[model samples]
Target chain A: DQQVKQNSPSLSVQEGRISILNCDYTNSMFDYFLWYKKYPAEGPTFLISISSIKDKNEDGRFTVFLNKSAKHLSLHIVPSQPGDSAVYFCAAIEGGATNKLIFGTGTLLAVQP
Target chain B: DTAVSQTPKYLVTQMGNDKSIKCEQNLGHDTMYWYKQDSKKFLKIMFSYNNKELIINETVPNRFSPKSPDKAHLNLHINSLELGDSAVYFCASSQEPGYTDTQYFGPGTRLTVL
Candidate 1:
């Protein structure tokens, strides 16, 4: 059972444009959500995170919006650059547990120059 | 310097073989975790250790065992390797156990069982 799901397997966007990646979860117990960016042959690096208490969080060019009622979250990157091309994974964790992360299958994002 | 480091970046062995992957973290964090990414790119937690004590043990196979010699090191040993064990293993560390804080991940060690 995949608690977290990234419906889109791949996405493409033009440079200097906005890129949006979507993720959905079935588990209601998850209170913290995080987005990770991974390059080929490397580990997933933490990008941005949002707590259940807040509906949105932003870091530089990246912004994450969460809708608890719908159990959906979306990541937006403004003015997407070529360096933003990578696999993006959305992960969720149940609060007050061991902090075990449940990750999605990932969405490959390609920013065209 | 690498905050989280795992040895044997690539390991290939035949079935029924015994192998081990070592991990170390220098961030002085109280918690550490081991995650496995399968061929389908699904990442799952296999085990977690806090202050050298086992905290969370997932429903992993009995062939896999995790050893924490100290708070900064966690090693995974497989008694009998199988084809299903082929995946990229990652070691991560955090200041505490929970999603409130960010956890750092290593480069990952790719294990191949022939």
Candidate 2:
């Protein structure tokens, strides 16, 4: 079973615009959420993260919003740039001793120039 | 210097063969993990080691084993490799045990089994 899911396989946005990537999870035990950006032929790098207690967290141009009630979270990038184009994976952290990271299928975001 | 590194970026082997992938981290982290990205592009956790001790062992087969000589090194050994075992393996490290909020990853090792 897929505990976390990214419904959109791909997304397209123009430079200087906003890019939004969405993720959903069915497991209520997840306490923290994170987003990772991956380039081709490379390992994923950490982007932004949010705690279950907070509704939003921002780092520079990246912002993550979490809604526990909806069991969803989103990553928003302001003034998207072509360099921001990459595969984004949304992950949920199952706290406690398990401390597992449940990842979504990932969304390929293409930023147009 | 690279924070996390893996040796033999690519490996090709025949079925029933045994192979080992080596991973090391210079960040002085106490936790290390192995993740496998399958053909369907699903990244799943196989095992986690903290301070040279096995912390989490997922539903992986006994043929697969993870060994950590120290907190900075974790190795994965696969026996009787199967075609389904072909996948890109990644090694990651974090400062806090059981806390993966911010983990660094190494360039993956792609394994192909014939």
The best candidate in terms of lDDT: 1
The DockQ scores of all candidates, in the order shown, are 0.79, 0.65
Q: Residue by residue across B20-113, what tens digits does model 2's lDDT show?
A: 9999999998889999999988999999888888888999999999999888899999999999999999999888765544888899999999
Q: Candidate 1 chain B: minimum summed lDDT over ten consecutive residues — where?
A: B97-106
What DockQ would you assign to candidate 1?
Answer: 0.79
Query: For model 2, how does the per-residue alpha-carbon lDDT over A1-113 read when each residue is reduced to its tens digit?
Result: 99999999999999999999999999998998999999988888999888899999999999999999999999999989999999999998977764567789999999999
Recovered share of real interface contacts in candidate 2: 0.54
**Where does candidate 2 stray beyond 4 Å?**
none
Candidate 1 — what's its lDDT?
0.94
TM-score of chain B of each: 0.97, 0.97
lDDT of 2 at A15: 99
Error of 1 at B34 (Å): 0.5
> Over 4 Å off in model 1, which ranges?
none
